[model samples]
Every structure is written in structure tokens, then in C-alpha cells.
Target chain A: MKKLILATALVAISFGATAQRYFSKTAHIKFFSHTSAEDIKADNYKSTIIIDQATGAVQVETLIKSFEFEKALMQEHFNENYLESDKYPKANFKGKGDFSKVNFAADGTYSVNVAGQMTMHGATKDVSAIATIKIAGGKIDGSTKFYVNPRDYNVQIPDVVKGQISEKIEVTVKATLQPLK
Target chain B: MNKKVIIIVLLSIIAIGGGVAYYMWNKPKTNAADVKPNYILPADSLGAAFAKNEDSANAKFVKDFVALEIQGVVDNVFVNEGNESVIQLMTNTPDYAVKCYFLAGESVSANKGEKVVIKGFCTGYLMMDGVQMSKCALIK
Candidate 1:
């Protein structure tokens, strides 16, 4: 009986160590397009992200309709003609990296490679980028900037306004996550 | 036809085309306060609708560009990193709440535990963030 009790306690300890997760609901995700004719930008501040400290796993999800553009006409065209947000309202990213070298107890910024599957506009593609993880005051701040071609994700750009939009769109993700209690 | 008549017709076409192009370029964003809500109910019902079937809920409230007026007790209120006010309303699901993202520079007067009505457009629901509403306005 004594041995069995010790084994159960040890299992509980191991489970607790592997279940460390940090979450944030209001991550900021912004995308910009620049061209000779025009520069357009949109911001989405309601993205949800979860990071597992034990396994270095990260997941992010944001609604396509949540993105707000400066011009209503451009936003309408983006939804109706380009993205078709009514059909695919969510964009998701799931990736993992090596977090073994970093010590979460201390404050520092570490650069890591993140490889993931990005799903948007009903298309999924593999993506890899260098992401920065900043630890301060026991909080995790993760940020990454990357570029993606809209056509790769099946985003059709009409030829009439091709000059007004960039072929490659710049995407930035930033979030400050707190330990999940 | 006379050359003079043809010249006048061509000029008129160019003028009308310019006007239409300008209107499309200068269209305004949607303001929740200025538009009538397509659905009016408690926040809990909205949350439950999404919880039950996300696709149908999105098709009905989000894809159709439906505005909603939700009444519920305030779960919390805070300003996001973008300097926009965000209000969370209590729902039947303990793990989820209705998040309303108010327009920039909009003042939110409701306090925690207060029952209030909020008007906004349903952007859709994230599994982790529940139902999200943008361009929010305080109705009461």
C-alpha cells in the first residue's frame, strides 16, 4: 500500500509538470499590403493564442471578419471579392519549436524557429518563420513577422486592381500571454 | 452625328465615371449605434447559439452581417492594447463570454456586475474566445 501511494503521487507530479500552458485572448494580428498605387493595412485585435511551455507548442486563431480596415470600401471588397469571409471566417496556425534551451523563470529574449500549418480562406499551407519569445515579469510576449503570398492561400486578386495591391502581404503577430491558472 | 454632340457625350461619361469612383473610394465604416440591430436578445442566448452549432450561428449572425443588441451582466471591462474598450458579458457557459470590441475613442460607462445593453456586429466566434462583436456601442 505504501509503494502504491508513492507511485500515484509521482504520476501526479509528472502530469502537473507537462501541463503548463499560457493563454491570451486578445492577441494583435496585423497585415499590410503595399504597392506603387496604394498601401492598405488591416488590424485584428481579438486573436486567441495558446502556448504550452512544456512542449513549445503554439496555436493561434483569429476571425477573418474581425479584421478592420481603414477604408470601408476596401474592407467590403476584401470580404466580398477576395477573402470571402462569409465562407471561411477563421484563420488558424499551429506550430511547435524547441524551447528546451530557454529558462522561463528568468527574463530574456530568445529567437526560435517556428514551423506550422497556416489555414486561411479554406486553404492550408506549410509556413516557417523566426519568432521571438520575450520573457519579463513572469509573462510571455511572443511576436513574429512573416510574409505570405495571397495567391498561395487561394486568395484571388482581380487583375483590374492588381497594381493597387501587393503580391506579398506582410503579417505580424504579437501577444502577451499569462499563465493559465 | 455631329462632332460637337459626340464630344459632349464623351465628357459627360467621364464626369459620371469620376463621381462613381470617388463615392466608392470614400465610403464610410459601419457604426453600430447608427444601424438597427437585426437580433435582440440576452448575451447568454447568443453564446448558447454559437456553442450549439457554430456554422449555423455564423451563417445567421455573422455572414449575413447581422447587428445584435445583447443584454447581460457585465463580466468585466478593460481597454485593449489598441486603446479600444472591450466589454465581456456573462453567459451560460462558464468558460466563454461575449466579447464586445467598442469603436476607438468610445467611452464605456458600465461597471462589473451591472446589467446593460450593448449593440454591435457579430464578427463570429473563436473556440477559445467565444463570440466576438466589433464596432460595439453602449445602448444603455
Candidate 2:
């Protein structure tokens, strides 16, 4: 009888480890560009992200053509000329971090150091950022802000229109995670 | 020379004016739709049942109904349900749905395991065949 009880406890703990994985997505993604004439900014708050609590494993993806612009014509150019969304329809990220030892017991803010490979326009790069993580009421929230250069992902800016667009753009990401099981 | 130039300019104006009037009178009419401000994803819905297929052709991409194949459930939306009982779908997605009115004696819906592609403007009401407006239906 004691052996049966012990075995059940072991299974429960192991199951808990995997069951803690959570993810929430709203397709919320934003992009910004700067130019001498005006700043171009667009965002869609519907990006998707998933995280494994025990392993700190993170996977993120956003629709490339989902970026919204204020001007209809500008949006058309972005998809056809700049982002080339048809060829590369998604920007993806897959990375792992250490969350087991982190302080998640309280309802406060934590600045987490992250290192991962972000794939945009079919190219992957190492990325590191300080993401703010919040835990409350059995829910976990994460957000981060960063910048991307067009050249980093081979995004082309024609010289004739170079003055109309910015060289570097800011990107911000936010996600909420819910228990999967 | 000055008189000739002025005559040319006046004639040009007359021709252009006539052309403008003809174009305006013969141009195809566009159905202007109202902006629909509300679209909410259903709670805990997943893709399961298939949208009923009817033998329909000439189905306005999203005329009879508005639906989003979100997660799994067909979140069929109608700004205001009135006379249109069924809609033929041209596209469906997790985020949005586009459809049109069907007049052909045939029906079309997404096939099994097929996903919706494309996104478009959403409206608050449905407009019918340039004659009158129904409550509200999804349009392509």
C-alpha cells in the first residue's frame, strides 16, 4: 500500500512539470519606422506567444502581412516592396530560459534576461532582452521592447525612397499566458 | 497665335467636361457599407463542425453571413439577421470571415480541414443587390 502511494506522488509531480506550460495570444504586434519627413508606425495587437513554465521554453510567431499602417498606399508598399510578406509570411522565435529558480510566487514585476534566436524574413539572429514578467492570480504576463534594423533581416529600402522611411524601427511585444491543462 | 491658343484651351475644356459626364453616368456603382465596430472571438471555441454547404454559385464572397473560423467553431455573425437564412463562404480564418450572397443554384463552403485565407473590412450591416439592404451580412 505504501509503495502504491509513493508511485502516485511521483507521477503527480512529473505531470505538474509539463502541465505548467501556458500561452496566450492576441496577434498584437507593432512596427515603427522613422524618416526625415514623418515617422511611420503601425501595430496589430494580435501576436501569439507560448511559454513553458517549468522549462522557460518560449515560442513566438506573428503574421508578416498583419502589420497595419495609417495610410492604405503605404501599407501596400510595405507588403509588396519592403516586408515582402508573401515570401516570408511569419516572424518566428524559439528560445529557452531558466524559470524554475526565478521568483514567481508573488504578484510583482521581474526583469528577466532572455537569449534566443529570432527568425524574420527567413533569417535568424541571436537576441537578448530584458523582459518584464508579472505574476498575479495564477496568471503570468510578459512584455518587452526592442529595435530592429532593416538590414539585419535583409529588408530593402530603395535609395529613391530611402528618405521617406527610417533605417531603424522599434518593436514591442506583450503576451499573457494561461495554464494549458 | 494668342487667339488660337485660347480657342484650343476652350475646346479642350468642353471635351473634357463631356467625357467626365459620360464616365460618371456609365461607371459601375459601388455599394458603400457602414463600418461595423464590434467583433469578438467566442469563448473556448474550437474548430469542429463544418459550415453547411448548399448548392450555390454567384455567392457573394460573404453576403449571406459573416463568420470567423476561430480556433475551431464557425463564429457565424450577422449584423442584424433578417431575410437571409444562409450564406456561402469564400474564406474563413481564426481571426475573420468573408462571404457573399449566393444566387447560383449551387453551394460552396470550406472543405474539410481547409483553412480560410485573406482578411477584409467588416461592416455593421448587410447590403443586398443594389436594390435594398438586408439586416446585415458579411461581404467579400
Candidate 3:
């Protein structure tokens, strides 16, 4: 009976160790487009992020409509013409990295090469970026910057303002994830 | 005389176009105070609806662009990095809640477990997360 009890306790401990998942409801994700004619940027603060320490897996979801642009006209054009947020309301990324070297118990920063598929505007594309993961006070702060060409995802820019909006948009995502309850 | 009228008409059209463009460029973001909630219900029901069928809920709320006023027990309240008030309302579904994002200047005055009503535009439901509401305002 004691042997069985010990075996059960071991299994329970292993399960606990593997469930190192952190989540954040309000992550910040910003995208910027720059051109000689104009510079446009939008910010989305309602992004949801989940990071798993065990598998080095990360998932992010942001509502396209949640992205707030400074100019209402720009926001409308982005939603109606560029992104079509009504049809594709959410943008998501699911990816993993080699985080086996990072010591979660210690406070430090680790850089990992992440490869993920980003789905937005009813299109999916592979994306790779080097993400910085910082561990501090039992929380994980993750941030990554990457560039994407809207043309790759079939985001058509009208001829009238093609020069005003840059083809490549710089996207930055940051989240301070807390331990999942 | 006809040529001069044509010039005046063309100039008037150009001036009107420029004025419209200027007004649109300077238009401000939507204020939460001006929105009327299209759907008023318990927060738990809204979460459960999304958990049950995300597509339909998303169509009705996010795609259709309907605002919502949800009332429930406050799970927690905090300010995000953007200095916007975020209030989480408890739901029946496990690991899911109604997250309401208030405008930048709106102050949230709700404690954990306090019952409250919040109105906002439903953005969408993230898988494994709860429904997101933006530009939220405290109705009571």
C-alpha cells in the first residue's frame, strides 16, 4: 500500500511540473506602417496570450477591431478595406521555441528563436522571429518584433493610397503573463 | 458666362471634398457614453454562449457590431499597460470570464466579487479566454 501511495504522489508531482502555463488577458500589440506619404500606427491592448513553460509554446490572440488607430478615418479604412475585421475578427499566432535552457525559477532573460503560423484576415502565413523572454518575480515578460508584408496575406491596398501605406508593417507584441490559476 | 459658372461649380466641389476629407481625418474615436447596449444579459450567459458556439456568438456580437451590457460578479479589476481599466466578470464556464476594457480615462470602481453592470462593444471571444469588450463604461 505504501509503495502504491508513493507512486501516485510521484505522478501527481510530475503532472504539476508539466502544467507550467502562464496567461495574460491584456497584452499589448502594436503595428506600424511607414512611408514617405504617411506613417500609420495602431495599438491593441486586449490581446490574450498564453505561454507554456513545459513545451515552450506560445499562443496569442487579438481582435482586429480592438486595434485603435489615432485617426478614425484610418481605422475605418483599415477595417473596411485592408483587414476586413468584420469578416475576420481575430488574429492569432501559435508557435513554439527552444526554451529548454531557460531556468524559470531564476530571474533572467532568455532569447529564443520562435516559429509560428499567424492567421489574420482569413489567411495563414508562417512567421519566424527571435523573442525575448524575461522571468521576473514569478512572471514571464515576453516581447517580439517582426515585419510582415500585407500583400503576402492578400491585404489589397487601393491604388489611390498605395504609396501612402507601406507594404511592410512592423508588428510588436508584448505581454507580462502571470501564472495560470 | 457658362464657362465662369463651370469654374465656380468645379471649385465648390473641390472645396467641399477637401472639407470632408479634413473632417474625416480629424474624427475622434467613439465615446462609450454615446453607445447604447443592444443586448443586456448576465455575463455568464454571454460566456457560455461563446463557449458553446463561437461562430454564432461572434456573428451576433462582433461581426454584427452590436454593443452589450453585461451584469455579473466582478472577478477582478486592474489597469493594463495602456492605462485602460480592465474589469473581469465571473462566468459559469471554467477559465472564462467577460473582460471589459474601459476607455483610457474611465476609472473602474469595482471590487472583486462585487456585482456590477458594464456596457461596451464586444470584440470577440478568444479560445481558452473569455469574451472581450472594448470601450467599456460602468452603467452602475
Candidate 4:
């Protein structure tokens, strides 16, 4: 009985030591497109992000339909024609980065480059972006900006409105992560 | 005579198409404040559904763009990066809570621990976060 109890305690301790995961549900993502005719932008605040401090692995997933546009028709067209959100409901990014330079025990800001595969509209592409992360008072704040081209993702835009939409769209991400229990 | 008729028909079609394009570019969105809620429940119930099965909960509550009137205790009230007021409601789980993002020009007047009703469109459940509602309006 004594040996069994000792083994159980050891297992528990090992599990506790491996709890180095942080997560956030309210991450924000904004995409902006600039054209000579108009500037189009949309925001999606319901994003799921997970960061493994031990392995420096990061994953982010968000619903495509959650993006809100200024105009209702524009949103509808984006869903029905451009993105086909009904067919492809979510966009995700998975990658690994180096988090060794920053000490989680200390509060400070760190800049790191994360390379990952971004999958959207049923197409996947390699992407790398610089992330600014701040650890303050037990909370982690992170933000990054990247550019994506719709053509690369197989998103076709009608020629009639080609000049009204920019070829490259700028995507910005902001998240506040808390230690997962 | 046939060529003249064809030209008039083509001209009318072009004019109609232009009018439609103009309207689509300027269509008004549905105001969440004005619509009747499809579901009126406590915060705990909604949270429980997602906690039980996230995938099915999303299909039922999230995809349809259902308007909800959720009553719960205010956990935290703060302004987000966009300067929009956000009200978080307490749930059964500490890690998950319902967050309501108020529409622009709307403010959160409720204090923490106070019970209030918020109406908005349910976007979906963020895996680690609780359910999210956007364009929320405070109900008196």
C-alpha cells in the first residue's frame, strides 16, 4: 500500500509539472483591403488560440462567418460568393515558434517570429509573421500582422469589381492569453 | 428594326444592373436591438449546452444567427480595444463565461455582480472562452 501511494503521488506531481499551456477565447482578428475606390475592413473577435509554453507551439482557429463587415450586403456577398463560408466554416493556423528567450516567470515584452500553415477556404499556405508578446501581471498579450492574397487561397473575385478590391489583404491579430488550468 | 429593338433591350438591362449594384453597395444591416430574441434563457443554460457538446451547440445556437436574451450576473465590465463596452457574464465554469460586445454608442451601466439581461446575436462558442454575443443591447 505504501509503494502504491508513493507511485500515485509521483504521477500527480509529474502531471502538474507539465501544465505549461496558455489559452484565449476572445482573440481578435481584423482584415483590411485597400483599393482606389474604397477601403474594406472586417473584424472577428471570437477566435480560439492555444500556446504551449513548453514546446513553443501555437494554434489559432476562428469561424469565417464571425467576421463582421460594415455593410450587410458586403458580408453576404463575402460569405456566398467570395469565401463560401457555408462550405468552409473555419480558418486556422498551426505552427511552432521559439519562445526560449522570454522567461514566463518574469514580466516583459518579447518579439518572436512564428512560421506556420494558414488554412482558409480549403486551401493551405505557408506563412510567417513577427509577433509582439507582452507578459504583464500574470497575463500574456500578443499581437501580429500579416498579409494574405485571395488568389493564393483560390478565392475568385469577379472582374467587374476587381479594381474595387486590393490584391493583398492585411490581417491583424490580437489576443490575451491566460494560463490554462 | 430588329437591331433597334436589341439596342433598347440591352440598354434597359444595363440600367437595371447598375441600379442593383448601387443598392447592394449601400444596403442597411439588420439592427439587433430591434429584432425579437429567438431564445431567452439564463447564462448558465447556454453555457451548459456548450460545455456539454461544443459541435452540436454551435449548430443549434451559433450557425443560425439566433438572437438571444441572456440573463446573468455581470462578472466584469470593461472597454475593449475598439472602444466598445463589453459585459462578461458568470457561468458554471470559471474558464468559460459569456461575453457580450455592445454595439457602438452603447455603454455598459451594470455593476459587477449585478444581474442583467443582454440581447444580441449569438456568434458561437470560443473553445476556451464561453459563448460570444455581438451587437448586444442592454435590456432594462
Best by DockQ: 1
The candidates, ranked best first by DockQ, are: 1, 3, 4, 2
Q: Which scores greater on lDDT, model 2 or model 4?
A: 4
Q: How displaced is residue A27 in candidate 4, in Å? A: 3.6
If ranked by lDDT, best first, what sequence of candidates would result? 1, 3, 4, 2
lDDT of each: 0.87, 0.52, 0.85, 0.84
- Per-residue lDDT over A38-148 for candidate 1, one digit per residue giving the tens place of the 0 to 100 score: 899998888999877778888899998778888888888888789898888889999986766666668999998888999999999998888888999888888999999
For model 1, name the residue pairs that clash: none
Model 1 regions lying over 4 Å from their true place: A1-19, B1-13
Across A1-181, the per-residue lDDT of candidate 4 in tens digits comes to: 9999999999999866665787887789999999989999998866889988778899998878678888988888888799886567678999987876666666999998999999998999999999998989877898999999999899999999999888999999999987777
**Regions of candidate 2 where Cα sits further than 4 Å from its true position:** A1-19, A103-105, B1-73, B76-137
Question: What is residue A46's positional error in candidate 4, in angstroms?
Answer: 4.9
TM-score, per-candidate, Cα-based:
0.90, 0.59, 0.88, 0.75
How well is each residue in A40-129 modelled by candidate 2, as lDDT tens digits? 887654356776767788777765544556654666577678777545655777887666545554687777777799998778888777
Task: Judging by lDDT against the true structure, name the best candidate.
Answer: 1
Q: Candidate 1, residues B1-140: lDDT per residue as tens digits?
A: 99999999999999999999998889776569877889999999999998988899888888546789999999889998777889999998865589998876777888999999988988888867889888888988
Interface RMSD per candidate (angstroms): 1.4, 14.2, 1.7, 2.6
Backbone clashes for every candidate come to 0, 29, 0, 0
Model 4 TM-score? 0.75
lDDT for residue B75 in candidate 1, whole number 0-100: 88
Runs with alpha carbons beyond 4 Å of true place in candidate 3: A1-19, A137-139, B1-9, B111-115
